[model samples]
Target: MNLIEKAASRINQGDALSADTAALRSQASPADEPPHAPLVQRAQARAAEVPVHAEAPSAESEQEIAERHVSRQITIDLERLRAAGMITPDDDKHQLAEEFRLVKRPLITNAVEATSSDRNRNLIMVTSSLPGEGKSFCSLNLAISIAMERDRRVMLVDADVARPSLLGYLGLQAERGLMDLLLDPNLQMSDVLLRTNIDKLSILPAGRGHKHATEFLASESMSNLLDEMANRYPDRIIIFDSPPLLVTSEARELAAHVGQVVMVVESGRTSQDAVKEALRQLEGCDIVNLLMNKGSSTPLDGYGYGYGYGYGYGYGRSGRS
Candidate 1:
């Protein structure tokens, strides 16, 4: 008999396949080899032992599993951040930290006093007119500053789908995140949301790229996701590191969902015309703030870092928007 016939005959006789059967199969001629059909039938028979409608895991249990998955903490290198002139929780006294403090105040206030009409005030996007203008840097520092709040938590999302840099700044490897969440309805926020060594701070990488990324950002799915992030926790703030307005349509689409926009301008390098064009793209947003980075202002404490803050018309040397 052929291998399939022998195996099926043994199974029908309520006998397990012996080592002899395995040896026989190994030595069998090509024509004597078992077809896959019987093996599939055997698998089906085994699977029939289990009920088709097994009880689903409870919501609480699923949440626990998600929490366990998100508990893997991403440790930010504080020394690296210090050397890069970024904010660290331990260095609240640094000039950059203080500058970010002024930058984050109005954002926090708007988030706290959000009316029903301003439902998404807590969702902020940091962008610039052109590349290399320090939007990512400002986004990182702003998120860190907000995370340092006593009662507030922050989720920093890298929305610059074209080129992701937040993870590089934090010294983290890219993994499944925002794009995955949008593409797969099966993915839970906890499956990709990363907790960090910094208390009250979490991160969502840009995830994989897609050709329709701008469409995805402008989709109803993204709006729903933003709503969930905004209302999930009363004390949480989400910061999006967006693409440059003049360079990509992604930022404008993303701006439609956020209540506030912080446009980072390189003081001397970014011309007034460039800032105006960038601001024009954000005219749909009610709260647009300007942050001037790498300005002509003298370095603070001789640390080679300077910051200046102003409202709609004023521009300073240090970073502010």
Candidate 2:
């Protein structure tokens, strides 16, 4: 079999899940339509239209890779992630892991659909009302879960330039990334991308934090980067682990370029006012999903992370609590 096909074969033979939330699957509507508040400005659902052609070869094109930086492969501590209640292929039956599956299903459905969204619909940003609400935890697991999918490859970008925790969490070394390209025109994408041991996962660290991180995120260079990534590979899904809306202006800036946003709310601590404020900051977004993290009870007892996962406005999903 060809390389990608071979990889897919291995993954399909290796994935399954379980999570606790009372509604994990029990409250799921027979119809997949998620229960979410009406969007302020919904992007035109161009479900039937095909994308226009680009002039240059796409980012993931073989010809482009010929001159691009060779991606360096790295490994993650699957055991560590699992112990913390994150999703792991070795133990997909774990509640946290299973919960993540349900979380990603609808997002993946929207992402892979054939259409031209307000922006790149496949590009999803994961953030929270404030830091310490488990945005990173959810972002990492969501990326891993999507990567495990039989037909998709995932690119997880640590976009929280002010402070990035994804690389550290995955136990992978960090190098140049998003900001590096915007600041130094000489920097190529390959310099920052890390190909992980996971079959369909790759990552881009938040590079050196810039004093103008917010400005850099909204710069023309950043726009170009997102466009290139969106059209690069048909089977690819690009996810941004963004800064919290209440805490930084960067998340708002980043939101302008993506089609979907996911807000993570700490189960008991985050106030309703904070959630409303966070949503207000992302007022222009076409789609928004809320994931209730670290909820009241676990579906399965023995394991930890009482994060009862829920999907709302369609993408009530997140990583291990």
Candidate 3:
């Protein structure tokens, strides 16, 4: 076998060893085991009994790993979302949904119909000038809107390492996600990715926090992870809910890797200078679009909500409507 094949073999072996160790431990009775012996010793004893050249992974072992690595499924509270004026799968006719529909059309077009030169257009980042400007709200709505697409899948990543609110918004508890993937090479994307009851929608939490999160966001591993996320499935759109650009260095570092950015500007709240400086930090990106969120416009529907979209600000603007 070649080096790649050998590596795969070893990984498979390791997985099988892990499964066998668990089985042995579970099967061992309390009277059969010494209480003082470390768990590692028991695992080692089980490993020593196996042949040096073990058989290839069995069908059962593969099934076990598949079951173990399957994404944790979650159910979003549709009623809570509807009550909060957010978009839901069943209520596409709502005004908020209509607004997001307008907001997502150009974004969908950009991702679906991109030229060879367009680098990771499907990997979009959503951020704001400062916190509590409804970036998270916009991020969730945009993700749900895209997930409504017939031909697309959306993965919402909580890249706000400092303050993650996506899980709480969806009424989910803390779990391993993006940070764990960056910190541990053994943790596969399947292990942390959350598969929602919402069709074609997945979520990656911010995972555990690290002091050098800015450096982690800028690392080569992060680049590779982003590449995998962008290219693994051609129909997938990865939306990152990043931190406020002016508030955290991590967002600026993250902006460099994505092809397009949606900077949310709350009407009458975020200062012009803050927006300008935030956009300046994202200068490396090829496509930067502005989203006017939480406006006071009251349409005939009696809902005081509005949104505006700035098509494109960088090269290859012709593709966007």
Local lDDT at 117 for model 3: 75
Backbone clashes in candidate 1 total 10
Q: Write the per-residue lDDT of candidate 2 for residues 192-303, one digit (tens) a residue.
A: 6787777778888899988988888888988888887887667888899998898789999999898777777665566767776776676677667677665545433656
For model 1 the TM-score comes to 0.73
Show the lowest summed lDDT stretch of 10 residues, model 3: 15-24
Error of 1 at 8 (Å): 83
Candidate 3: which stretches are off by over 4 Å?
1-69, 300-321
lDDT of 1 at 306: 50
Instruction: Give the TM-scores of the predictions, in the order they appear.
Output: 0.73, 0.75, 0.74
* Residue pair clashes in candidate 1: 289-321, 290-320, 290-321, 291-320, 291-321, 292-320, 295-317, 306-318, 307-318, 308-318
Alpha carbon lDDT of each predicted model: 0.70, 0.68, 0.71
Q: Is candidate 1 or candidate 2 better by TM-score?
A: 2
Better by lDDT, candidate 3 or 1? 3
* Candidate 2 pairs with clashing backbones: 18-95, 18-98, 20-299, 138-319, 311-316, 312-316
TM-score, candidate number 2? 0.75
Model 2, residue 187: C-alpha shift (Å): 1.8
RMSD of each: 25.2, 15.4, 17.9
Candidate 2 local Cα displacement, residue 206, angstroms: 0.4
